[model samples]
Target: MRLFLVLAFFGVLSLSAGVLMSGDDQDVDWLIAGGLFGVALAGEGARLWLRRGRAKSHESSGI
Candidate 1:
């Protein structure tokens, strides 16, 4: 979770940087933002899913 949060922070930073760097074109900025945000969301989702699986396994094992 902490790692995901850091990655998400970096993703937002990249998006903001892309926008700030974009002067004559916005398409590139949008693309950068989309990719970064997409990866961040996917990573966070996977992290949550893994955590959930771990919890279920622990419950089944009586641990």
Candidate 2:
């Protein structure tokens, strides 16, 4: 998951710069960048939620 998040982050970053600097959007990167960004964001959110739930359960269980 960490590797995936890093990969997605770089992909989006590089692709975003490429698309913006280019004079046209006639490339596959434009489409792929959005997907990578979305996946990364979703992964981050899931990880955050899971961590919070774990902490709450741990606190309740007196562990």
Tens-digit lDDT string for candidate 1 (1-63) = 687677869787878977876777754577767777777778777988999999988785556
Candidate number of the best TM-score: 1
State the lDDT at 5 in candidate 2: 69
The candidate that achieves the highest lDDT relative to the unseen native structure: 1
List where candidate 2 sits over 4 angstroms from the true fold. 1-28, 61-63
Each model's TM-score?
A: 0.62, 0.53
lDDT of 2 at 4: 74
Model 2 TM-score (2 dp): 0.53
State the weakest 10-residue window (summed lDDT) of model 1. Answer: 24-33
